[model samples]
Target: MHPLADTYGRRFPYLRLSVIPACNFRCTYCLPHGYRADPNAAGPLSLDEIARLLRGFTRLGMRKLRITGGEPSLRRDLTDILRTAASVPGVERLAMTTNGSLLTKRLDAWADAGLNAINVSVDTLDATAFAALTGHDRLSDILEGVDRAVERGLTVKLNAVLLRGVNDDQLPAWLDYLRTHRVGVRFIELMQTGDNLDYFRRHHVRAELLEQRLRDAGWTALPRAADAGPAREYLHPDYAGRVGIIAPYSKDFCAGCNRLRVTATGDLRLCLFGEFGIPLRALLQRDEQIDDLVRAIGGQIGRKEKGHFLHEGRTGITPHLASTGG
Candidate 1:
């Protein structure tokens, strides 16, 4: 059995699966121009393969699943994948992270297919700035998509990547916008990944500084919500929802990391920044028995590193967050 340790020695229960490596937008910070796609990268996993892996994982005591991708909505059968995953014996909650451009078309269907919640990436509210950041001129589309998601009764959270000269000044405004719209906003610190490492180093804002700025804006850090991530969350006494900061670079939360990631091509990553992953595709292709699959998974978990070392730098890695299923 895989003895995954929690605060009280509890086995890990959450899994983040990246269903595809294809994205609709090329965010400047995520994957700038000139980045070449891998010629030998495997295609997306079949729905059956995804279902089989989830079944094995659920049997191993996983209950929460978050579907991510280059942009998970880019997948044609994403609803089917969500439905199959939800049908697993022990899987209880199914969530997804997307760029939100295509969510308008799939929101209701995804909800019907067992998607519980969604985290939408919206860096700024300005149309011109949005286009500059994402290499797409579709701010109106993204906004409409968010509206559609909320209208469908989907719990929506806005993910804002806070870069210094880029969108730092808009933090309060973003929070105000989400509050007026009754949506949650999360501020993510720029990590040293993709082509934005230099930009991140130059404009990276720390959580402490962010909190202080919020204080200056008359907000106070509140006790974090139970389901919240590493983001130190805050609330304006007058706002409907809350604002949070995810400072992965300034403050690492690897010890409390209860999640594992499965890349679209079927590589199971133990941690977000971990160097290696276990290949589930090969094992599935070999038609490994259920019991054997479980053992292999458990062994991989045993070898899971304590956490990722981002300071070590991406010396030879080439996969950006988008292609890696972030």
Candidate 2:
């Protein structure tokens, strides 16, 4: 099988496909308050288009598939998408990253469709604080979904974006809650994605500080196998769960980056922080050879930016995180 490798020799076996770019909530660090979906913009990839792309990637040795979105559960044909992805011949794992607001009722359906793992975004457990941060009072529903995912025996992970004065203090509670359960919790550092520049600058907490806190609490590094995902895992001897950090801004997390991002609109993103993308959706309809299309994608993969543009003192790209699978 042909492996998807970049110029830097990073094999791109993982594909993060955004099924939809419209989400239900507006978390402070992600979407701006009162954000509305831009109706006039072109729609996301159709189901057929998504399947074809996944198949294409599979031929290039993509074994791990992850579906992300504004909220992946909100997609009307989520189950069909999941099944199609899982049916890909060599796809060994199918997973999703969702906000959990719409997951309580769909968790079972998702798992049955070959979903092997799930990562839910829950910044705070406090109801009022959750509502304040997300501009929604769906905290109960979310946590209930999290619990239901656990009960179903699905591999579960909780992602909490750590904001210095906001929910960073909840780390201990997050760890305590994970003790008996096998669910892992990852504390993400707030990123300077588009539109939330000021908020990111003001509230962003360093992952190092949180890691130090974990060490102080007696959390020890758990040796991970080579194929582990982005999170750097740690744990206390007595806890069944693990704690992790996904820090994009703290340092160069781009080296050995082995994933390719497909924006909701079917644009192939070479790098998360770069706007240069090959428009795969537009090319799908052309009567061209699939190999030619794949070759063009390979060219861009070789040109993947060396790092987040911030390395050169640039700000977020033109597109919003809601539009990309960030």
Candidate 3:
């Protein structure tokens, strides 16, 4: 079969799989009130199950798999998960998004397990601000983990959520760190998603403003990075690392939508701004063959919403970003 193309003809060669929906730090933007998963909440798909699913996706032409979570490092089986994902036949890349609290101890193991890339979420350069923002004081460890990953030659990316009144003022401090570092830094735009509208309304900074600031300060847009991922890549002549801006609100952000999401619980969210989902775990549990799974997923993709609808001042999406696998 050909690659999985949605109704709009955008082929999805990527999959964002959330293995665990529970996180330790309650980042103000994502979990303002803090979080505590239900003690009885069902655990995520098993390692074997996840491997099998990846094989099926690879069979359907998926080339990259990004493992995400409330915090992927929190899972004890993460190394195993990475090893399994890397072993998939057609998976050309295996990456992860993590908070880095546990990365210090596991970085070597993960690198050895064949994780091709890693994106660590680091919103501020100040330790106090980080604790205030995420309700945790592990900033040093997070930074150290990034340094270690760099030393080990891992393709590391830093994801910073630039909240206008929050960490926007720390850009210089962040840029200083980047000047000597080889890791790419991506400044992410705050979005109007889930129960965080109030936060979004207060802190959302348009990437347009950031772009203008970068140019004023001497950074030039590099030919859009070769990745074709959401972030638009840029560069500064003086800096050793690349810069990126992910503007979900901007008109061009969703133009080439080539990805789909599966929650830790197996909910197939066709679009980030929509709540409609096909319970993939149910189908998988029923022992439906790969063909059936593909048919069901293809039909669901055909129903992918035209856009995230943020332009209309509505995110219709209600699940917390963490729960939905951000």
Candidate 4:
């Protein structure tokens, strides 16, 4: 099988596929006004289309597949999607990112369907702050779900967007929880999107500060895996859990990019903040179109920009995180 590589010698072995566009929470940094469906937008891809897409990706050396969404759990057929991903040849890891609202109720079924790892968005440990940030008062339930996932033997991680004067000062709280959780909690730097200029200016925090704090507390930097996502992880002898920092604005941030993204409607995005997407739904419609799908992906990989223009204050067409499953 031909590996998916770019002109700069970066090989992509990870695929982040969005299965749905609708999310339930209204996170302050993401969908602050809640999700508003676009009347003219096409619905999400069908199961058959998803299967073909997965097969095509697997044929091109994709070893890791992450099912993302505005909230992946909202998809009624998510279990089938997970099963299909697991059935695909060459897919070594099958994971998903969710808001964790439905994890407690549906995690076991998802695990049975082949989901082995999960990343849940938990902005804060404080219940009131969580409600204020996510427009949801389900922190307790979500935490319970996290515990359940750990008990069920699934590799679990938590994502929290770092916002100044918001959840930024909660590192101590996170450290306290990490002392026993045995999970990884990544603090993602708030990004500037097309519609969040004002909010970005108000709350964006550099992840470097957090990393330094971790270092001061005796956290040792861990070596990154070849197919891992863009998180710099740290480990501490006193803690069972790990700390991860995702700083998109850091120098040479895109140099190690090893993943590609596909939207819910089957559009390939070379970069999270890219100016446009290449439509791939037509090729995904039939099993016989796998070759064309593979070619389309392989062909586009060469034209991927060396890096995103985010540092230049350009967010491209990404209006919000939800639009691209962040």
Point to the candidate with the largest lDDT: 4
Give the residue spans of candidate 3 off by over 4 A: 39-41, 225-227, 286-288
Q: Candidate 1, clashing residue pairs?
A: none
Candidates, ranked, TM-score: 4, 3, 2, 1
Question: Whole-model Cα lDDT per candidate?
Answer: 0.76, 0.80, 0.82, 0.94
Residues 1-326, candidate 1, lDDT per residue (tens digit)? 33345333435778888987777787877866733557898888998788778877877777888899888887889989988988888887788999888776778888998887789999899899999988889889888988887877777888888888888888657766756686778888777764656777887777567877878887777774333456677778778777887877564466556677788888878767776778888665544566666777877776666656776775224357775666
Q: TM-score for model 2?
A: 0.94
Which run of 10 residues does model 1 get worst, by summed lDDT? 1-10
Per residue, candidate 2 scores C-alpha lDDT tens digits across 142-196 of: 8888888888888899888888888888876776788887889988877776677
The best-first sequence of candidates by lDDT reads: 4, 3, 2, 1
Tens digit of per-residue lDDT, candidate 4, span 1-326: 89998989999999999999899999988889999999999999999999999999988999999999999999899998999889988999999999999988999999999999999999899999999999999999999999999999999999999999998999999999999998999999999999999999999999999999999989999999999999999999999999999999999999999999999999999999999899999998778899999999989998899999988999988999888889
Best by TM-score: 4
Better of 3 and 4 by lDDT: 4
Which has the higher lDDT value, candidate number 1 or candidate number 2?
Answer: 2
Which runs of model 2 end up more than 4 angstroms from their true locations?
A: 223-227, 286-289, 311-313, 316-318
Give the clash count for each candidate. Answer: 0, 0, 0, 0
Q: Candidate 1, overall lDDT?
A: 0.76
RMSD of each: 2.6, 1.9, 1.8, 0.6
| lDDT, candidate 3, 73-128, per-residue tens | 87899999999899888888888999888889999999999897899999988999
